[model samples]
Target: MRRFVCDCGSPVYFENDFCINCRSALGYDPLRADLITLADWGGGVFRDLQGNAFRYCSNGEDFGVCNWLRPADSPSQFCKACQFNRTIPDQTRAENKERWLVLERGKKRLFYTLAQLNLPLLSGWADPQRGLLLDFIEDARTSDKYPETFVSTGYLGGVITINAVEADDVARATVQDELGESYRTVLGHLRHESGHYYWSLMNPEPMLLAEFRQVFGDERKNYQAALDAHYQNGPALRWRERFISAYASSHPSEDWAECWGHYLHIYDALDTACSHRLLDRSPESMSMSERLRAWSKVSLMLNELNRSVGRGDAYPFVINEVVAEKLELIDLAMDRLRTLH
Candidate 1:
């Protein structure tokens, strides 16, 4: 993420709704990908210093869960990022609002990175044939509404489903431990599931599909059966030699998505490092090989920094030779996906 500052020079954040130093209301302009200090223009409208009129997304105005702005005359109730939300957690429950807030923050961050990459993004509502949708729902784990339903975080059709309970720190940690995961977070889940969405969107042609098979294995393999075998036994032997994570060894598609997610993770982290003057060049200027090389140094420093502060490694997974090859293919695939925009 790029560093942001309030007009008064106080440091702000991507998720900020108000400037601390200037005490000014803030609104994020999705088109510009910038956080701007706003001046109330009256009657639920706001204007920046340049007098561009805007209104808070209905989700923001009503739920305080979003900080994005829409053009005052746009007629859409939601911001560009929020428009993809097909279902939000039921707001009647007191805890659901907080969960929704956390979920929205992750979604906005994911959208920001996707926009930065110049990827095509359309709402399922606008173009159901080739668009994305998000669903934040509750199941037996977090709500009484569904006593037997369990909503897993995943992508299917054109929609990404995230269990709202994943927003709760305790609940997430418990699952993380139960699953023997090294690291997990709301943003991580969003990025990973989005990989699945984009892979489907790509729908690679024969030659490209052949290359995908060469890099990540045959995606035509039985997915559910592979997953069942993986869970019943364990990750394939010597998974670390080829996969980004143990779970990535479950199937070829999972491997592709896992590598895709890591590509985003590395891109964002390297971009942030460059923005903060910790790196000399941005990820955009680097080839896949250069990115992998630079990420090695930066990720090492990141882990050391975390250790200094008494925290565990910020990034626990390693990019091995096989995984690096998969990431390179994913990088190329992203270039093709960008053409759809």
Candidate 2:
């Protein structure tokens, strides 16, 4: 993320709701992708630097779950980001409000990277055919009120459904133990699910598809059967030599998505490292080999830092030769996508 400052010249963060120096209210403007300093102009009115009036989103005012700004000229009261939501968790439940806040923070971070990459951002409400949406839902497992429902966090068509329990620390930790997973987080879920969404748009040419197959295996295999076999029999014995994670070994398409998610992770982390002067090279300048080398070193340090804090590795997966080949395919895909701009 880029550095942000308040009107008082105090450094602020993307998630800041109030400037510490001047005590002015702050709201993130999704259109400009910046945290704007707002001046209160009396009852329900706030003005930006240009004297353009705005209002805190209803979600912000009502639930303290959002810090997004709604333009005064906008007919809809929802902010640019909130307008994309198809369904939010039941806010009447106090626990649901906190979970939804966690969900929104992850969603906003995801949007930050997407916008930085200059990728298209459209809402399902805007274009039913291709736009994206989110649904944060709870199931019977989480709440007695929703007895008949069982919602699994996954992506389908253009909508991403995140199980509300994933936002709860204890609940998520329980699942992590149950699944025997090494690493998992709200941001990881968002990034991985987004890979599925983008795959829908990845109409690679015949030659590119051939390359994809060579690197990630044949995506035409029976996905459900592969997944079932993986769950029942466990990952292939030599998975460490080929796949980034045990789950990535389940299916070819899954391998692609896993690699794609890792690609984003590496790119974004590298950009931040560059911004903070931790790296000598920017992501745009680094070759695939350079990025892999840098990431390997950085990832080791990240794991060590987590270990020091008595937490699991922040990024537990390993990138082997085979995974690197797949990642190169993703780099090619990203380059091809750039041409579409």
Candidate 3:
């Protein structure tokens, strides 16, 4: 979420493929965690200002759905992030291309935050037992081709499935209303599902698992039955006193993922604030407790800024004492994951 600039002193965005001022081709090099302005070096190769050779990820080159770069010598066609894709939307459909673009944007942002946190992110192709994968697909509700299939945005095994229609604003909003959810977005879904992936990746030891149970409750509890009860009855009474969102009250695993998603949200926002010079220090330099304290003030300012523009609150949930404790556990878990990386 940090601001980027082209070499010509022109501000560029993360998603920009070319600089407006210098017309320099832009590509994000994940290895360097930077956006580099590239010069055409012929034969589909490019060199950055420092003469680092690179090639556009095939997804970017063929489908215009990614902006990441890979080493010119790499055997793989996909970027580190796109390598996680198990299935993408059918690109032959004109509308699916646009939907895939939006989905990729959300996914890239998720990878950015994950990289910033230094978390382990291997592709399922690399490590089928523990690695991650993604599926951007359609079902009966969104396409006639799959008349009996219903795809829910969720994570199972190593794959995260995002129903492609979530990319459509109206469709997502309609589902949000029908489910009586306060907020939902593609990025939110991506972040939440990533929590599941990493949680499975962690496979915590006895001590850490015991700590997690103490903080977030026993994840061993029946997940489906809990979700069924939650939907049939609604969120637990006084859920706001203990959880980040109403849906978080559905299950212990869900509470963990909700807290994990909000942790990323707060960290990314704080990092952006620091990059803009609105904050004196970056979240990386702060402890988990410090970041939470900073977010408490920052979230309020963010809400007020949205109000000034006649928009809804940018962040609608509250992080109560109980939730803060759970987030702290998540922070500790991230630290452990970083060590494993």
Candidate 3 structure quality by residue, lDDT tens digits, 3-95: 999999998988988999999999999998889999999987999988889999999999999999999999999999999999998887898
Positional deviation of 220 in candidate 3, in angstroms? Answer: 1.2
List, residue by residue over 50-133, the lDDT tens digit for candidate 1: 999999999999999999999999979999999999999999999999999999999998899999999999999999999999
lDDT for model 3: 0.92
Q: Give each model a TM-score.
A: 0.98, 0.94, 0.98
Writing each residue's lDDT as its tens digit, candidate 2 over 1-341 gives 76788989998998889998999999898888889999999877789889988888888888888898888777877777787888898987888888999999988888888777776777889889878899988899778888767688888999999998999999899988887888778988898888887777667889998998888889999988998999899887888899998888899888887888888888888887787777888877888878999999988988898899998788888888888888888888877765654
The clash number for model 1 is 0
Predicted structure 2, TM vs. truth: 0.94
Query: What's the TM for model 3?
Result: 0.98
RMSD of 1: 0.9
Top-down TM-score ranking:
1, 3, 2
